[model samples]
Target: MIDPKLASAAETFTLQCVINKRPVSVDVPPAKRLLCILREDLHLTGTKRSCDIGRCGACMVLVDGKPVNSCLTMAYQCQGKNITTIEGLAADGALNRVQKCFLEEGGYQCGYCTPGMIVTVTALLNKNPEPSMAEIEEALSGNLCRCTGYGGIIRSVLKAAEQGGRRHAGRHESA
Candidate 1:
């Protein structure tokens, strides 16, 4: 069953933002988590929900070129912001370089954390292009993945960085 508060919240607020370079408008409650808004309201479920808090990073999204835990962010906070999710990473059905690297490196096992990991790594490579091991670790510190043991995950990111990914620094790139 849907919560009455969520319904009421949806009725009380309206948000306007660009998601994956496309403008989106939603009516939502002020307190609605960005995760819910993305998955439930906007149907962008590529950004998963795990732990329901900021620690998991499962709901990571790019808000104006920075990675943010969407589970902890208010839906209304995204008004007029540029938001990017894992779904937005690809263009014309081609995998982004990070996604491709992750696939080749076997960065994911169960794949539950793949989206968040990709989101973080995408943001990291965008900012650092050629991040050191420590920077990669720091960029991914917020996300938790029990499947890949983080070995293949880090390697995939490093490989992406070595492959012209640095050119995307501080910007969002579509695969």
Candidate 2:
């Protein structure tokens, strides 16, 4: 049960983007948020949907290696850009250093916000391999975790940096 006019209008705009090193083209409404496209269309649900107003970083993803709030980004605006979701962080059945550190450090409690936290830390560590405690705090300010009290998460980031995670940070590959 759908309207033909609205469907046609939605089909008018096609978004072409590179996602996790793979080229993808999908027909979408011009005003559709990139979040919906990723979750609904592309089925990349690793990016969580919380606080849809952009106050929460649960929907964070990487655009051209920079962290962006996918909920606030329009699908049409992602044309020809590189988009990386949490699913892209691993390679060859191996978890990246950041993810491993998060696992070992007990960074997650409920695990709802782990994806965004890991993605943000990946971008931060990519830019600053050996980030100070203050730098880590500043980078993670936008993300909110209701569980685990952030102590384990901070330790995970610091531990990843100590393990030389910079090599894997910001490195996106096909999932």
Candidate 3:
């Protein structure tokens, strides 16, 4: 038998984090997943929730400028951190080069995995402005796409890099 007190009430904490480019503070249980925080509380649905145990990269996001599986990351772990979702990749009502390239290259079909794929690629391009095909493959190893095949996605990444990786190559942002 488990202790009733231990399970009766969940402990909560004040989470302070920078989401996208804005400051946000919220109260949540420490064990709660960041995926839920983004999709539910914060209402940033661009980050998808799938395979809650972290098997899928659908809930991937950038934490401190590196890709992280939000599903596996707890709320407390995000405290005082900078998080970037798919929505953050764009600015001023304009699509970022990576995003535009994806569209131009038809990088998605079904589209369930596009957000996570883009987030992961965004981090990679930001870190390495001109990544080779092998490098892109290695960086995206953790991200799985079931539709649209990988041809278009690869082309999109290549095209984004060729386009100067504007959003990615111009500047670097860290948590």
Candidate 1 local lDDT, 2-115, one digit each (tens): 899876655577888999889998888877888999999888888998898699888899999889999889977888999888988886567888999999999999998889
Tens digit of lDDT per residue, candidate 3, span 38-117? Answer: 99999999899888887779899999989999999999899999988988877765677778889999999999999899
Off by over 4 Å in 3: 1-9, 165-170, 173-175
RMSD of every candidate to native, in Å, equals 3.1, 2.8, 3.1
Return model 1's CA RMSD, one decimal: 3.1
Candidates arranged by lDDT, highest first? 2, 3, 1
Candidate 2 TM-score over all chains jointly:
0.89
Q: Against the true structure, whose lDDT is highest? A: 2
Model 2 weakest lDDT span, ten residues long: 166-175
Query: Which residue pairs show backbone clashes in model 2?
Result: none
